[model samples]
Target: MSLQPIDSTQRIQSLDVIRGFSLLGIFIVNMIAFHSPMYYYDPYSWWGDSINRPVYWWIDVFVQASFYPIFAMMFGAGLAIQYMRAEEKKAHFTSFASRRLAILLGIGLIHAFLIWSGDILITYAVAGFILIWMLKLSGKMLLILGFIIYFLPQSLLSGIMFFASMVDPTTVTYFSSVQDIESSVANYGSGSFADIFGQRVDDWTYANSPAGFISIIIAILPLMMIGAGVAKTKLFEKASDKKLLLSLSALIFLGLGIAIKTSPYWGEKNLAFVFTQDYVGGPLVAMGYMTLLLLIMTAPLSAKLLQPLAKTGRMALTNYLLQSIIGTIIFYNYGFGLYGEVTLMTGTLIALGIFVMQVIFSELWLSKFKQGPAERLWRKLSYSKK
Candidate 1:
């Protein structure tokens, strides 16, 4: 007997729905970087106008750091699912996983360099390789390990920054330089493709600095572990029997997430508060969202309503890359040259427009095909006997 991929009947509708939902948030956040000098400017002051500030605040509290954690967790869940399938079939999990991640790395490199500087796929793929090694641990242990690894470094850094801010508030707000910002505006807005490529490298380098590995590990790996842990406990299989538990967990998580996320606003947008808000509160909100979506999915009516989103989620990778492609065309010099020109509100609206178009497109495309083109290619390469 040989291993085979899971069919549509075995797929989780709720998971798909959640994944589809996160794509919107991720695009919304990415749009800010796509059309602006996001890397060089301190966001708080850059979007400080009365009009943009409220838009920025809405993004900060509800959208910014909130969605990616959910996606990272889901990525781990996906790995765990494949691992369990491999084990069930007595196949070689490690080799298959390695090849799979390698392909993802290749795709990520192209996206990060040739397409967009703000790509998360490269980081995710690299961290996934690390996660594949630690899959042998028990689920509860994985969860505990994830919590400790994430909390310790994040809290310590937040504390250190808070202390430094006490000495001088500017210490935490000095990531910008006039030349970098001006250069970004120029290159992305009106330069040739070669010029834009040069700027893309600079932007990617700044975001993925070599020294930030530990930070990236804590940021990405922990959520992934927690997700794998959840999968091990068979939460998806057994969640149906625990609707009440899910309900309570959703409320508590959402409440705490919201309260903590408001730290920058109610407490003050100091480095400490900002760190706490993004690093600590963001994941909490992501958890809340996952649970809440799961709970809603339990309802027959709600599940039916969210079926379209599930389709979107099923084609996640295709849509993600498409977002970058479309975003660049709309804003980059090669397209409309609207880069570094749109307001926050306008950029956000564009993101929404893109998502809406994707939803319609996914629905139409999946009506006949089993998956997105990118997913088909990934599966073909991974499962091909060649």
Candidate 2:
């Protein structure tokens, strides 16, 4: 079947709203690296200063590792949505999805190598390719697989670290060396564009290694599958029907997630605990957030208030790249050279300001155009000659 574009009227407001909300959280977390060297971001060691410690702790407990899963799950939901649309039109799913992901991979490469090393687009694109095959799984199987894929690697690593640390008290290291930290700061903060570009290349290289690649796939792909399961179940579309189940899930998952995530504060920040907090608790909290958003969207009072966020979500691809562009310009040496100069609080405030502007821009832009600029480009490329 021929591919057709989804009209604005056909868009789901809740997905857009939740996606926009996730962007704010993502920026809040990413601002740390944008303004400083992330190689040594240990709160207990690098940020020993008491004043900023609390801020960092709050961000870690509430913001970090929470929203990425939400974004990933939403991506899966998007694939499922596209699949459903394709089925409705009697089109081939794999062909369209493969081309779409190919274009996304190109965009991700440009962003990762040229713009920022911390880009998640490459992971998303790679995971998207894998997600196409798992779309046929039942919701129960998808959820089970999501948990298994996400936790198995972390669990094994955590077990090894725990056992090793028990055998050798000094086996566990919490933060990077001071020399590495200083070098990172120098390269990112004051180095020439070439120097910074070289550093970015190194960072990307480390992140794209076989081990790193597998780790990311295991972490991300399962969430995407769960998201596909959510789409298949029509959970969001039929929110009212599953209100009780969603409410209970929100309570249980968020409670357990918060408990696991906060365990680091009570003890040492070892590899085992870190893995559990991020790999396990993170996705749980993200699901809780999703269900909570769905519940909120059911309320009539929230619809008007959420419209701007929905607009932002509708143009997420454009805004995501824009964040990288604007953030790098603000913090990199080639631009304002504010790297390593701003505190976490200041960085967060800046992120919030940028997000506000983006929301306004999104609302205005959507009024005139059918899709965000980048979204339009992606769709154009994906549907070309279809």
Best by lDDT: 1
Model 1 TM-score, 2 decimals: 0.97
Best by TM-score: 1
What is the per-residue lDDT of model 2 for residues 277-344, given as tens digits with 9 covering 90 to 100? 77777877888899999988888788778999999999999999999999999988888988889877
List the candidate 2 regions with Cα displacement exceeding 4 Å: none
Return the TM-score for each candidate structure: 0.97, 0.96
**Which pairs, if any, clash in model 2?**
none
Model 1, poorest ten-residue lDDT window? 209-218
State each model's CA lDDT, in order.
Answer: 0.88, 0.85
Give model 2's TM-score versus the native structure: 0.96
Candidate 1 lDDT, 1-386, residue by residue in tens: 33566789999787788889999999999999889988787788889998899999999999989999988988988898888888888888988888888999888999999999888888888889999998888888988998898878888888898888888888776466889999998999999999999999998888777877557766999999988888877777677777998999999988998999998888766667888899988998999998888888888899999999999999999999999999999988999999878899999999999899999999999999999999998888777462
Q: Supply candidate 1's per-residue lDDT for 44.
A: 86
